[model samples]
Target chain A: MSTDTAEKYHKHTPAPIDCNNVVISLRNIRKSFGSLEVLKGVDLDVCKGENVVVLGRSGSGKSVLIKIIAALLRPDEGTVRVLGKEIDQLDARELQELRSKIGFSFQGSALYDGMTVRANLEFPLVRNQRKLTRQEVDKAIRQVLDDVGLSRTIDQMPAELSGGQKKRIGIARTLILHPEIMLYDEPTAGLDPVTSVEINDLINDVQQRYNTSAVIITHDLTCAKATGERLVILSEGKFLRQGSFEEVFHNDDPIIKDFYNYNFISDS
Target chain B: MKVFFLRIYDIYQFSLRFWKEAFLPPYEYKEVFNQFFEVGIKSLSIISLTGFITGLVFTKQSRSSLAEFGATSWLPSLMAIALLRALAPLVTALIIAGKVGSNIGAEIGSMRVTEQIEAMEVSSTNPFKFLVVSRVLATTCIVPVLAIYMGFIGLLGAFVNVYNNEQTSFVSFFQEAFMKITFLDLFTLVLKSAIYGYTIGMAGCFNGYYADQGTVGVGRAANTAVVVSMFLIFIEEMLIVTLINTYR
Candidate 1:
């Protein structure tokens, strides 16, 4: 049964948060699966053009938080608002329209396996963007391919691409929509260190080039350090800390320090 | 009994969701056509082959029974009625339930495990339209046509049986067979096949879309899809026969 706690406001926030200019807002967000509570009264606010990286060990509900932001999963309690609109209030059409302005990039790229790279890039535009002419569709496809530096592989099927190439195409598919908010789930996961750095750098480039605000959930410190200006370490279902990268990186908290040190928890 | 009732209620809700989403705007026309080709044209050869074998076996078996009463001349009329009104349609639907049902279930279940379906939803694409609706509508439209094709091919198989018995003329055999058949028989034939089509489509997608287990879960979905759809086809045929018997 759903708890119907969607209207509950934050009761134990450490400090008052400024909500003005916030693109994504979660107030007392709580989610549980059976007996295990993955998120317990989590609160966060991401503003325009800001990149907030959520750091966590495996199974810390980092991915769940990102899914909730997209309204893909509803919280058992508390309110979620994306782009200033309450997620629970939007109708199906309104939700789709809202989603068009936001992009979600999954770790495996989640590219449609049956589609070629050209078709994968064309999917969102063909599905949602009705005003784009043929020329515009081609232009958008070419631009995003160029942005991801995968223009040569446009005609290649997703199966033909390498792990890093798939992730790049995954990001590029999201970028083609020119989303105002990008929700990335472990963009650098399952890649070599050099490729991981390349992807992290590419994410920074997309932020500048597309002027989009982003929420990245990762356990990799190198990925977090490279892409995140501000960082929030999630542990035991609460925000352990949130501040500029240097502020969280150098803090003396043992738990926060462990999150940084044990970044490869999921590697095994 | 309790678990069975619960399953029935769950399927009812699942079917209701499909109907509600089906009527919504932003339908995927291209995807629907693609599904038609996948469900219809791809299924023809197998359906035809099955239909032919079924007609030959049933006609040969029935001839031996009629010979006991020296009523062998009634063979063509009886063969046509049985094949057209029941056997061909039901058998064709059962085959489709096996082939198409398992396919939809496995495909969607794999997509679920891979998070492709979740990705589609997050990207604001109505996967219900692109995946479920296209496939369901294709089956609904195509299965009835396949059933009709099965009936026609089975008649040819019966003609071969009649030739073995010295009836010898194709034209005379077809004329005699169709003479006793009524429009009501044909109507019920089409109606039953369409219902069977709808059942397979719904059962396949319902099992697949809700599959939560990993790879093993996908296998369970495919298995359950074929089993449930085949059972539904039998239930529908029984209902159709009862209705026809009651009114006619």
Candidate 2:
């Protein structure tokens, strides 16, 4: 770590957290693909009902970090505890059971193109909770569609839906399971400003309504500012700045200043 | 060389996993049935056309040669031997390796690129059971049925040509054909068709499930599936023919 990065890390490192409230806790998490080290000794804590936005440019290990939390990808070295369970030690069945408590929303929406919106939502619900009657399944699907404001698109295939609508459906599919921790990978990416704001609002609504801790991964400052209660800027493989959105962005560091200028100026 | 060996190892592991997961409980019966319809019922028209044309053309082409030798009456038996032994199964396998193999590759490759497979995983649905095992099982079970259907259709086509040329009755032609065919030939046809189907399915699914790099990768996967399935089908055909011939 550079002198500037080390100082910033020491200065902004989070204080000890209450184990009861922390839904996800990672200490010294490290991951590498081939010889390319993507994450180097990363640490993070996501408290219950807290929204932590990880801000980073492309290829900066934002997605990898979240995948680690979801146990979709294992870390090479570190302790990962999600929902009070040690992620690295879980067997296949245990990991699956743990995964049921977390939802991952991919950037592309990842809706099954062959399935209609209703079937897509019912997929997770029916698979994880198999005892639900047909009426109960229909009710759950309807409720989630309503939550995402896409109730009318219940019978339509993903190909018929617009990009923003697909993203909404993707979130609805994840939310249908009522996961305790929601990992949103670039939730507002590739959406119009208006639609992005709507998604941001939906994220906040989910946080309040479901009392779910979430990790929002994005480089979009507007989304981070709107949805995140706490923000951390990841550069290279470490969190170089951490605090509230304004606190992290308003810094003397050249990298932070450049990122802020680039986003705002480019948008204008 | 190292990458090639690693890929071979990966495919071995993938095949082993499929065998292990396929027999596990909570099978995706609905998806498997859907794949049967997709792989079998949908390919009926093409298979019928090819089978009929193959029988009619091969019989007509062989008639003149047999006539020159004063053995034209043996045409029915010769046609039966060729179709039942090799033509029907080989043609059906090649056709399916081109059609269904590519379809499976592209569909699964697109899903991988779009993250639908991972989505299935996060939804607590075992994607291997739902997607890979279902399709593989459908192909393995359904291709033989199609091949048998093709063989009968080919016989009808041969009868049509024989009737046109020699005014031979359908009953007599069929009797002559059946006289030359034995139980082992039937067994070989079914066995060859099943092996080819399994090869096609495994090739398509393995390439597709591992596809990456986006749309270009999907196209590559589809192409590789067809090529690899066809190649394996030919090799398997040769090996099975040699093995069965030893018994004969």
Return the top candidate by DockQ: 2
Q: Please report the TM-score between candidate 1 and the true structure.
A: 0.93
TM-score of predicted chain A against the true chain A, for each candidate: 0.89, 0.91
Q: What is the C-alpha lDDT profile of model 2 across A88-201, one tens digit per residue?
A: 788878988888888888999999989999889988888889899999999999998898899999999999999899989999999988999999999988999788878888
- Model 1: fraction of native contacts: 0.77
lDDT of each: 0.85, 0.89
**Which pairs, if any, clash in model 2?**
none
Best by lDDT: 2
Candidate 1: the clashing residue pairs are: none
TM-score of chain B of each: 0.94, 0.99
lDDT string for model 1 (A11-96, tens) is: 21122223468999999999999999999999999988788899998899999999999988999999999988999999988999
Error of 2 at B47 (Å): 0.1
In model 2 chain B, the worst 10-residue window by lDDT is B120-129
Could you give the CAPRI-style class of model 1? Answer: medium
**Candidate 2 lDDT tens digits, B81-180:** 9998999999999999999999999999999999999888877678988889999999999899999989988988899999998999999999999998
Task: Report the C-alpha lDDT of model 1 over B76-191, residue by residue, as the tens digit.
Answer: 89988998898878888888889999999999888888888988887778887788888888888888899889988898888899898865699999898999899998988888
